[model samples]
Target: MASSNFNRWLRPEVYPLFAATGVAVGICGMQLIRNITGNPEVRVTKENRAAGILENFAEGEKYRENPVRKFVRGKSSEIMPNINNFFSKPEL
Candidate 1:
């Protein structure tokens, strides 16, 4: 009777928790292996510092005038242009 109770608790269909945990652990292990061998890029150094800065600047400038940002800027200016100006100024 005690063995029957243990069998009922250990039924395979009722133990998906262990399966799910094993799947999650397997995925993490695969990702760790991929990251360890995936990247072969050379490291950045002084010679490329100016090029790196320019690349970052251009990337940022590309997003500066995006439509969503422009719309938000327009709405903010319409709603509170004076407040924007007040904040934009240098204080004495």
Candidate 2:
């Protein structure tokens, strides 16, 4: 049963999924490293906050958001815009 399951997951069609997952993992790892090394917020320990040494960064709000999430938020949520518009139209 384990062998059959392993073979089922080893198909050529499944290669793309593995590649995509690898790429995503690599990107996330790189981003995590970049943030850990460069982001000031990452260095902010709970003890530091309690000591009241926190400085107000003007761009703090921007730093808190992911660019992809910001972009996705601006896109329309409608699956079928035409159908929705038609249904929403008032009858004369």
Per-model tally of clashing residue pairs: 0, 0
lDDT of 2 by residue, 36-67 (tens): 76565666566744765457475466566668
TM-scores, one per candidate: 0.31, 0.50
Instruction: Give the C-alpha lDDT of model 1.
Output: 0.63
| Candidate 1 TM-score over all chains jointly | 0.31
Candidate 1: list runs displaced more than 4 Å.
1-9, 41-92
User: lDDT of all predictions, in order shown?
Assistant: 0.63, 0.78
Backbone clashes counted, model 1: 0
Off by over 4 Å in 2: 44-52, 56-92
Relative to the unseen true structure, what is the C-alpha lDDT of residue 20 in candidate 1, on a scale of 0 to 100? 90
